[model samples]
Target chain A: MQSIGKRAAMLGVFSGGAILLGYVESLIPVLFFVPGMKLGLANLAVVLALYYFGPGDAAVIQLVRISVVGFLFGNLFSIAFSLAGGFFSLAVMCLAKRYGRFTVYGVSTAGGVSHNIAQICVAAVLVENVKIVYYLPVLLLSGLATGLLIGLAGDETMRRLGAPPKFYDAVSNQ
Target chain B: MKHRERRLNRWDMALVILVLAAALAGFLLELTWTGQGASLQITVDGEVFGTYQLDKDQTIDIGGGNRCRIEDGAAWMEWADCPDQLCVRHTHISRANETVVCLPNRVTLTVLGGEDGEVDTIVS
Candidate 1:
């Protein structure tokens, strides 16, 4: 078993990496025509944490990343939106991973789609107009594409880093 | 061992197909719901500013360094000084309920149709 200090260090590293990735994502030019679409690069850290350290650690990293990024680069509304999306996405991804029937790609894709759906729901409430739902189709497609890309990256990174934790093996074998 | 674990399985393909089908269905549903609107309604900070006939070609300066244009029965954000310019980049909207929103400027332009009364009932 890892020592307490070692586990804490791992958490800190994941959180820090997630925050850095969030900042990098903000630097990319907005994908015009789709107001909220993004590559979601920061999710890589969360995905890694989920697979290696489990859902609890992944949730911690996600929350830290969203709060820090929102405060630094966005307003209250953006923060609320991020919190909603982050929580919903993390929940769905956790469930998908726990089911053991899906690979990383499937889990991440589900996360991406849930994130967008949560944000759109928030937008509808704030704007007091359901017409915003019209953006759903395009947002869904973008989510699928970006999620697949993140999943591919996450899988390759884990492979190169060496054998996954024993838990991952057990999950996969099941 | 890891390579086999990373490979896409049938479940993954099924999930992707399901999401794609959902998107396509949503697109078709939206197409059926939208129709040519009669007027353009402008709102700022949650207050209704004014309504202009879509048939009338005109430019509306929404102050706060944002402008909207209506022509050929369609309305669009003509210009915006907001740093992101997301609203300005949006495509022209001619169908009922379509909108161009400038979050930074707190301005929204929505297309309204004579038949919108029915849509509002459904939404509410």
Candidate 2:
């Protein structure tokens, strides 16, 4: 088994990568007909964490990234929306990864769809209008496109990184 | 050892197709469903503040410094104090369940007709 110090170092690196991706996403000027739409670039980091670490560790990285990014680029309402989207998306992605017949692409697409749906729910409640759901169709299209992009990036990155030597060594030793 | 190629599989392609189909269906439904001879429903924060006939050409003060105008069987946002002015810029809506939303002002205007006059029912 790896030492605790080594795990902590890895988590730190993951969080740093997540935060940097979040910053880069914020810098991209993505204009959408619907308000509060985004490409969700930070999710690439979450996918990496899921592969390298685990779901729980990935959740931690996601939460930290949302909190930090929301504080820097948004307000309380925006933070609430992000938290709703992030948590729901993470849950769906984790479930798909664990119990469903889904690869990384399927999991990421589920995450993207759930994220948009959750954000729309928050917006509907906040604005007190069910009519806001009309925006769902466009949001779904955007989610699928962005999810596919993120999933491709994640798969390529993991293929390049390969399975670490430590994992095989630990399994053989056990 | 065999290397697994990093690419989208049939399963992923199927899921993408499914989502795209759903989105397309929704768009088509929204586009084709018309609310001809419907009434204009003005809602602020989800509450129906007022309803006006689409045939009635008049301007309504929608509170919060916003105004809506109905003319020529269509309704549009005439003026809005919101920063983005998106609602004001929106095209005239004359279809069932069509809506123009002002996020900044927390106001939504929709065209309701026949069985589609359920904004209150839906909200409640």
Candidate 3:
């Protein structure tokens, strides 16, 4: 088993990386003139955490990234949307990883779609109008595109980093 | 430590195709579901501002910062002083329940009372 200190340090590093990626993502312009459309580059860190550290650690990194980045760059409404989307995306990704015989691309794509749906749902509830769903088709396509890119990037990074230590798997298995 | 090759499998291909199909389905469904709207309703900060007939070709200044235009039975955000201007870039709305929203200005224009023949009974 890895020492507690070592695990904590790794978690901290991953959290910091996630936050930085979130901030970088915020800097990208809205693509295709679609409101709330994003590249979701921050999810790269979350995917890495999920694969290497398990869902529990992945959830920690995701929440930390959302809260810190949301407060830094967005308003209350934006934060609410981000939180809803992030949680839903992470949950779907975790489930896909656990049950489905899916690779990184499948898991990330599922995460992306769920994230967009969750955000739109929140928008509909807040605006008191269901018509906002008109954005779904475009949002879904964007999610799929970005998710595939992130998945490819994540997979490459994992390959280069090689496998985690045996004890790392032990921690994730728990 | 060496890991197995990380190439995508059939499941990944299936998931991608599934999402693409879902998107296409949603696009088609929306196209068929929306009917031509008779009027457009304006809401500012969750409160009703006014409702205007879509047949009336006119420009309305909303909250002194945004402008909406109704022409040829379609309504769209013609102008907005907001920084983002997302609403202004939104496509025209002629279908019932279609909307153009300006988040920065807290304004929303929703189409109502369409050819589907449901009268909007909600007052104010």
On TM-score, the leading prediction is: 1
> A104 in model 1: Cα distance from truth in Å?
0.4
Of 1 and 3, the candidate ahead on lDDT is: 3
True contacts kept of 1: 0.51
Candidate 2 lDDT, tens digit per residue, A29-52?
A: 657647546898989999878867
TM-score of 1: 0.85
True contacts kept of each: 0.51, 0.47, 0.62
RMSD to the true structure for each prediction, in A, is: 5.2, 5.1, 4.3
lDDT of each: 0.83, 0.79, 0.83
Candidate 2 lDDT over B1-124, as tens digits, reads 8996656667777888989999999888767765464787878878888877777788888885689898998999999986556688777888767778777677888888766544343211
Q: Which stretch of 10 consecutive residues in model 2 chain B shows the poorest summed lDDT?
A: B115-124
| Ranked by DockQ, top first | 3, 1, 2
Error of 3 at B123 (Å): 12
- At residue A150, what lDDT does model 2 achieve? 89
Instruction: Tell the DockQ for candidate 3.
Output: 0.54
Q: A-chain TM-score per prediction?
A: 0.92, 0.91, 0.91
Output the number of the DockQ-best candidate. 3
lDDT digits (tens) for residues B1-124 of candidate 1: 4554437888889999999999999989978877879888887766767788888888888865788998999899989987678898898999887877776666788898867553231110
